[model samples]
Target: ALALYVNHRVRVPGTADIVYWLADEWDGKGIFLQDADALVYPYENLKKVCEHINEKLPFVERIAVYATAADVLRRTPEELAELKRLKLGIIYMGLESGDNEVLKRVRKGITAEEMIRAGKMMKNAGIRSSVMVILGLGGSELSERHARETIRVLNEMDPDYVGALTLLFTEGTPIADDYKNGRFHPISEFESLKELLSMVEGSDFTDCFFSSMHASNYLPLRGRLPAEKERMIRQLKTVIEKADQTLLRPESYRRL
Candidate 1:
């Protein structure tokens, strides 16, 4: 049986790492003011904070932080290598969408090329990269393009983990406002499944744990890519063929 560790003191090694609260938001556009709410501590201050944590918690096996693709790409190879040496094994990033047009629509600033570049750098530095892509991000009109481009990008990056989340707008967000003004068209559940299916079919990964199991997704699927790709696709196809709501997560169960 597999050994389980819970509620125990760190007698041996532990996986929990201190997530240093560096910044509230990433300046993907490179236009935020110094006093803006987007960034929390400046880079120098963040480094000092990380150093302090490392000094205090020398036994921790990993340290992680969330960053935008632009922010991550801004890190030089030396910085990534240094971070790896510091036991910072992972950097979580939001790719959102790989289609440049969709990225522009969302004001995400960084292009798909930038994300790929950053992923390669992180991989080379021995950092486990966890990245997310938003489904239905391009609305109904560009759904296919979004899926195709996202699959292409993921295949290129081949990050350690891939998270797929369906798009949902919070109140007052630009996308929500666009929906109110009839400028955006949300994809139906069935249509979203088609997009997901297309993405899974098109993807070609060496080894990555891919999942659309986020709460926002209409259906949950998780498996290793290429190895379990066919099984995942078959699961989705079963639901599509049945056209059964009972087989799918209900709308009331969906959450952001």
Candidate 2:
């Protein structure tokens, strides 16, 4: 809240929130719940915070959330309505990929079926949801399946948004370790882009928001719905089919 005030960005009003009782590292000790996934406070404490914000910064419009574990919220349809009544706006969830192979290889710890359930449930609660997909997560062995299964899950979830992110072996991670030992082979930027488009083509989602405009992405593409989605995918594919690999983004710049 203070940061938003300081930034003078009244753009999207509501604040983001999180609840993770299961990851409460402080739960075992005398200390009740500790912040792990994010700050987890008592339900009463949360109500107080919302009340305080409403009383003071009434302009605050929406409350965005990214709760990894939906169990903690224990939110029913009525409860979600209560949250909206309290000015909670949008909720984002990561359906990383529908491919179980890619998910486990990345230690995502969430199954495709579970993601499908969670995402659809979130939409049912009137909370806007976001799903993320990673290209090249399955290496060459499962790349095609990764794209195919990912689309399968997306159709099942049909989130309001789908974020397509590239995979990279960042230094100091388990992925990096695998890279050094030749256990993993990183895909080129071009193939990653193709894989992203494939994920979309194989899927039958209609209005999902698409974005890869992050700095790390080789090409930052974003759009909404059928037209914009096709346009963005075509634009990216053109870049890949035409651009020379030797002359493409240099290693100093590309991450994934």
Candidate 3:
């Protein structure tokens, strides 16, 4: 099981104290330090927190967090190795879309090449990397390019885990405003599923676990790559061909 640590107090009072607080309040095998750029937190400070968790709560097996390509790039090889040694087992990064235009539109601030380097760096340092891609981030206009290029980049990164999430707009966000003012048009649910199909069909990985099991997705799929690749692809194809809405999650149930 996993415990979430997202309070702003985690930043002010320090991560180690928060770990102590969590240890008192919750019991779990893993802790998901939920921050937008958790790795950007000072290396020494993070290392200390990891050390405290391992020492104070020996049952916690993994420490995972959300990170960005820029955050990963800022870390030196030695620092990453040190963090891995301290039980920073995995990192979850958002590689929202692999298409350059989409990346620019979203202002991700890092190129696909840089993202590949970050993923490889984590792998070499013995830290598992889990990356996420948004299914309909390009809206209807660049849907195919988004899917195909994402597959290409994922192939290059070959992360330990790949999570496929469908696009959703939060209120007052620029993308949400764009949708309101006719500047953007999101693909339909089935179209998003089609994009997912393309990703599953095109992805090539050594031993990664690929999944579209996020709550935002219409369908849930998970399997080990290359080994279960064909079976997963066939499953997606059949779902798409059937076009059965009842087989998919209802829109009301989906959330960010």
Highest TM-score, which number? 3
Query: If the candidates were sorted by their TM-score against the true structure, best first, what order would they fall in?
Result: 3, 1, 2
Q: Which stretches of candidate 2 lie over 4 Å from their true place?
A: 1-44, 69-74, 246-250, 254-256
lDDT of 2 by residue, 27-78 (tens): 3211111233221344556556666656665665665555563442454566
- Candidate models: Cα lDDT each: 0.78, 0.66, 0.87
- Give lDDT for model 3: 0.87
- Candidate 1 lDDT over 1-256, as tens digits, reads 0012211233234433331111123221111122322113455665665565566544556767776767666677887787678666777788888899999999998899998998898899998888899989999989999999988888888899999898888899999999999999999888889988998899888888999899998899999988998899999999888888887787877863
| Number of the top-ranking candidate, with lDDT as the measure | 3
Q: So what's the TM-score on candidate 2?
A: 0.76
Runs off by more than 4 Å, candidate 1: 1-44
Check candidate 3 and list the clashing pairs. none
Would you estimate the TM-scores of all the predictions?
0.82, 0.76, 0.86
